[model samples]
Target: SILKKGGIVPVFEPTKATAATLALELPLPSEDGVWTVLYPASAKAANTLEDGLCSRGFVVRRLNTYDTVPATWDTATLTSAQSTDIVTFASPSAVKVWSSRLGTLTPVACIGETSASAAKRIGFDLVRYPDLPGMDGWVNAILEVIESSSSSSLCKHNFKA
Candidate 1:
């Protein structure tokens, strides 16, 4: 949306490495120039984007534009989630919240490595994440977990996020 509004043509890259390669192809600054980037507060701990760009001789100014907060789950929703065959987590915040509220007995499918790591640190025995990124990979990971769990016991094929 920002690129579209700014009339900047975007080269879509699926991974950070690919994006860094693309950034390397960009014209280098005559002098070190600051590139202002608006990012979510949740991702501040992993500033790979800024670090990568900076390494290419571009100064980066990151602005914390937003933050991710856990949503309050109602009693019925929480109960339903607890009974699910698997739980999917997109962010560490979600994993933390779910672990705190429901405990980590059910298996979890995480969207990315970061979330998967968080789940592991939180004492989740069964945590799965795809090598590839994005919703497609995330969904595939969930299905893989579900299939694996089904072999052990009767799985309802129900997943909650």
Candidate 2:
């Protein structure tokens, strides 16, 4: 098995559209057996992306991963912190994980509102999210924050520090 060959196979995290990504990724590679994937999307994600998957001959299912909000990322929180002023959920799956762990209402800053509202029934809220699509915006927001914080002495040479 690939697991035996490579140890535990890890899937990338913080995917906004886990199901979508799986639906796209699964068929590309050869898979076998009764395989299932968890897709955590807002109502819109659940509703809109279905036909596309069906077109590809996949049976995508939605799971209640209990992700309420997309993670608004603060580097400090990478180790210790109960919360943040703003968090970013780059993926819909990230939102689900945040929702499940934090139960929404955490004032998440996300890439878009659709992702924000995915967990709306669970009472999550969006603080300030980006409109530009994909990962570049997410990286920029984090960089902007890193630059603004006076106490953060992050240099190119000392990135880990």
Candidate 3:
């Protein structure tokens, strides 16, 4: 609907889902001012979709979107409790905000490469990103981490290090 009225959608190119959606939705190149619906943005895509669209040659008639706001965390209470086993971050913004409050979270599972990079840059040790790049993949990666941790305890008694 947005494309019909001259709006652009900048999707992440690294994910297969975005490519498939673009193939189905975007129109063929023509002289009609390049009425393309999908513009694949790499890891360094603009902060906002409207900015991404304009950067990629789409004329945004209106821009009414906002970035994700960071939520306040009760760090004092959390610091007294046990360390988190696994922390999942779906976006770079979440990683930024969460890491700033809580120094580092081990066994971190990020939804994509971009989020994983942010978490790692903030000193997260066990950050993992799925190869498939989706919600299911991210969940599976988290499950894998849990399973590995569970099994490691069984051999803790026999470990020399």
TM-score of each: 0.69, 0.36, 0.57
Report every candidate's CA lDDT: 0.72, 0.51, 0.61
lDDT of 1 by residue, 1-161 (tens): 55678998766544432334435555554555565544344443566656777787666667777677778889899888877767898888888898999898888899888788889999998899987666778898888887767664434444332
Candidate 1 C-alpha RMSD relative to the actual structure: 5.2
Local accuracy of candidate 2 as per-residue lDDT tens digits, 1-161: 35547887655333443445544554433365444434565553454445456556556586545534455667676445343434566556777766665566544555655565564545664344444545665565445544443243334324321
- lDDT measured at residue 11 in model 2 versus the true structure, 0 to 100: 55
Q: Judged by lDDT, which candidate is best?
A: 1
Error of model 1, residue 42, in angstroms: 3.7
Clashing pairs in 1: none
Minimal lDDT window, size 10, model 3: 14-23
Once fitted onto the true fold, the runs of candidate 1 whose alpha carbons sit more than 4 angstroms away are 1-45, 153-161
- Ordered by lDDT, highest first, the candidates read 1, 3, 2
- Model 3: how far is 92 from its true place, Å? 1.1
Query: What is the C-alpha local distance difference test score of candidate 3?
Result: 0.61
lDDT by residue for model 3 over 51-115, one digit each (tens)?
A: 54455555545433354776655766667423556678887788877777666745688886667
Return the top candidate by TM-score: 1
